[model samples]
Target chain A: MCRPLCWTYASGVLAVLAARTDDTNPLSGLVVADRPEPDVPEGWRLVRVKAAALNHHDLWSLRGVGLRSDELPRILGMDAAGVDEDGNPVVVHAVIADPDAGRGDEVNDPRRSLLSERYDGTFAEHLVVPARNLLPKPDALDDVEAACLPTAWLTAYRMLLRSGARPGDTILVQGAGGGVSTAAIVLAGAMGFRVWVATRDAERGRRAANLGADAVFDRGERLPERVDAVLDSVGAATWGHSLRAVRPGGTVVVCGATSGDPSPVELNRIFYQQIRIVGVTMGSRDELAGLLAFCAARNIRPVIDRVLPLHQAIEGFAALEAGDVFGKIVFTIP
Target chain B: MCRPLCWTYASGVLAVLAARTDDTNPLSGLVVADRPEPDVPEGWRLVRVKAAALNHHDLWSLRGVGLRSDELPRILGMDAAGVDEDGNPVVVHAVIADPDAGRGDEVNDPRRSLLSERYDGTFAEHLVVPARNLLPKPDALDDVEAACLPTAWLTAYRMLLRSGARPGDTILVQGAGGGVSTAAIVLAGAMGFRVWVATRDAERGRRAANLGADAVFDRGERLPERVDAVLDSVGAATWGHSLRAVRPGGTVVVCGATSGDPSPVELNRIFYQQIRIVGVTMGSRDELAGLLAFCAARNIRPVIDRVLPLHQAIEGFAALEAGDVFGKIVFTIP
Candidate 1:
């Protein structure tokens, strides 16, 4: 699964760049072209990308959410697996933050950013990241499988850990087709939790069952029993149901709001029921390491929607933008 | 100030009862009249009330929110200090639910009801409660002060304990004059937290500062700095401000929503900033015990607005309903 550190092709390499941003049509900015090899700063290492995965974050970047215009032509991708400069197989921890600034919790760093948001990213033959951001890739997971672990999968993994649900407790994952929801279903099942999914699409609901959801309900359907926690990425659309689905003293772990923000924040139900709503973003570097180890130890493999070569990265981004990806979309670099 | 358990008053006793309910004029339901002395059920003990405290919950009960029309003519107090049949000075823990039902946390019990909801309450000459619901009242706190703790003060104590803010960290308490808010300010300061208050009235804001608030700001004013957490009971009125006042990864602990339920639950800000909203209600019996010990050890006294004889309980309820009270309004039983 490891690729050589690309010492021969140092000048130019195939990469996907957010050449320009369009708020409505994020994929219009996706360009699959050649990029100059990145410069490794002090304490940074270059890794030759073996496989990179697409994320909603990539679409958001092209829509100018976190990526600024001045930082345009930025390479796109937050997750990857490859070989580091020292020829060690590694998986990239996408968050670039000063741990000291956040008092050792990188996610709390105000200036924390993902790979492509601040630097050239993993959707290339080669990319550079802080040396500390590399975790040893377990041999059990192939490059494409390991590549899917950093962004959506890592977010889901951390959400579950922080969800306050015990292994035997039940958790409701809202939405089924998104990358984070799919990953949460599989990981939560493997982690010994009873996974229940709520999705509008019946087909996706069935797939969720195959992916390890113990029960599947129509989106907004009243659950037969309240869950111990709810993992929610579809915000406003499912927020009410999420709140209603959790038992008293249960938690709602949120990573993203893809459907839009819910309003009339029901403070009454929250205070009366003693519900805990915990917000989570991408996980920490240590958490990512733990995720990789957990996946390897459990013999868990990420559900890849499709795999494409780096030159065909635009199609991957297009599929993700169209909400057509059921799981992860990976781009392998030859 | 322990009242003797009057064995002579076996037939009738003076009590403030909600004879009826009024949504607009809750005071219309108030009746200070004679009621038969409560019969102690199995495992229940009689506590001759010395002093009882008023809470907003009393107002809600009068308005028939939790008190049903069928359950009307119920007693109206939740906080009390008195002498048990064994002549020990004790503070009542108002929550009455089967410990087994809530798994030892009465607040989480689905059928949990306060003292006045299902049984006789403290605003009377004598009341009956489960024997386990009494704690030895600290001699350092007089009956009126101890009476205040079992309701608003205990609620505030629990909220701060569960707030996730460290001793040196700052907490923003929304509203300054209410029982919970006033208690939060005083207790938070005594617990080593820097207490910041938000209030609509300048006089009340000044009063809050006098009661241990480190700073006070106009309601909805932008804070100069984000706090580690926000204690919000103001609900819809301060919900948005509460969200914005907290630092990233900070918390907002909500106990009630007096102003109204905030609309637009702001799922975006909640998940994006990684804000945590923890809902808390009244403390458990253990927590009430802890509050007593903390107060006794720290020489903290609950703020009392005014004390009236139980015969004149209507005035106290009126003051609370009018929001003319700054802290607790206690009614002493003769």
Candidate 2:
């Protein structure tokens, strides 16, 4: 049996991880206890996890949105920075797409699954993953900081670069305080794109400006002029405004719609103005590598709102659910 | 007084070019008569029109959708193939953007306007336009055929190449027999891409197969597999199918929506799968030149469904509105 760790559910409620005979609602039945250690498969390595970061996806996992309870007692973490048995420090790329599954980009494979959804994740003291998932962590980043790079930072990096913005071009980042939005503001600024952020929260707008935004606007407010591109992760609520903020022949890259989906699409505005709306998911392993290199080369650091001991992970999940954190909440294994 | 050949719109009847005016739609009140020839501005040339093609935009012009009644006696055609005063045969590229517009590509310019919308079009025996709009026509293509290339064919070329299908990739052209769809199927085929077409009419599907479609399917029928890209011009009715038919990471390029706009978007499918949807309006002068060279080099011809004398234009518009033609309809002049 593996050494147990914490898991979260619904909102703030949390429980200790444990083996359950009834696979349904694994988190509900979780109770901390000792279990046999995981055996690493060939071409995989056993990572002695030093840190794991909590993402909104983890809470969703606990609510069993993406995972069946049968996959339960499932380890629930996507971002991990750890040391190998050989003692090399590394960061794990969360998306696990089968290389041979689909045509073209591996990230597009329908069969792909992130860690903790189909496989046990990095929340525990030790976890097993395909060796290919590992990237050497930059020495400049501590375990907690490096743990934030794989999911949110990597997604933000790809959305900015691959969505067709050039250096010196102005970009409007929609819904500013989320993980990807914050990452986009910092990265676009570093890459020489003028960054303007929109947020409903006045304080978050101020925080974005502090984080190097060229300008900050109240959510849904008209800008002085149209921009070259819009980085949109806020869905439904900001969809119309995002479309309005871009100039003709400009692009809007959407990675998520946290508010809701199925917004009214202004098709006339889309076609008549020749605006492009591109959809992006979390990025690929290659993109994660590039992101790591980019951040490391430029000494870019992820914002970490709070760090909790692994045993105190319940508090970390609570912080995320309360939406009180400015950045990521990480759990360090003692 | 200047002589102007004009169409008059009367109650519940088709607009007809008349020698004398009667009370009706004020914009169409002018009679067909001799007009003083327009003076060519510097950097512009006068073309003695040998042929002009009528499009829906022309009919819309007659309906006063884009022109004012005060702008009546307006010559109305966006496409022309003619000889300049120097007697060199040329095709006029219809999009007239500001020459000094700031740009990476001229298509990105905000001040761009189509001929006949903001400027007098090419319907008359003589028309004046900027010299840059003239693309020398190959001797092999007659004036009527050359007239068809500027709007529909150029839009198709830009949508296929610039909208991101690499040669040898597979594309699903939604709606088999419109001007743009036919152009796309033929151009994509000639450019070495595997082309599949979707149409509601079985006969049109068969015709698409004849026009070099690798395969043709019923509208919204499941393709054997997803294509690398989809060319969508039929907007509302087929937008969802277009989104579904493209493989993850593939693109859907739209030029028009003959059916209507504001189709329900499958935003969940789009973002979850990482799809791209781009909107293209028309082509640039340089793209028109490339398209001309491509056709000239490959012996590619625009498919003409019917050719009529300029006076028989009402019949052409009737056939177009009736949706009976499989390809472009051109009007010839003596």
**Candidate that would win on TM-score:** 1
lDDT of 2 by residue, B121-200 (tens): 77667788998999899877888888888888888898887557778889999987778899999999998899999999
DockQ of 2: 0.52
Model 1 residue runs over 4 Å out of place are: A1-11, B1-11
Per-residue error at B240 for model 2, in Å? 1.3
Q: Please, what are the lDDT tens digits per residue for candidate 1 over residues B28-107?
A: 87887778867889998999999999999888898888888988788889999999998999999999977776645778
**Candidate maximizing lDDT:** 1
lDDT of 1 at B26: 85
- CAPRI grade, predicted model 2: medium
Query: Any residue pairs clashing in model 1, and if so which?
Result: A236-A262, A263-B264, A263-B265, A264-B263, A264-B264, A264-B265, A265-B265
TM-score of B-chain for each predicted structure, in order = 0.96, 0.88
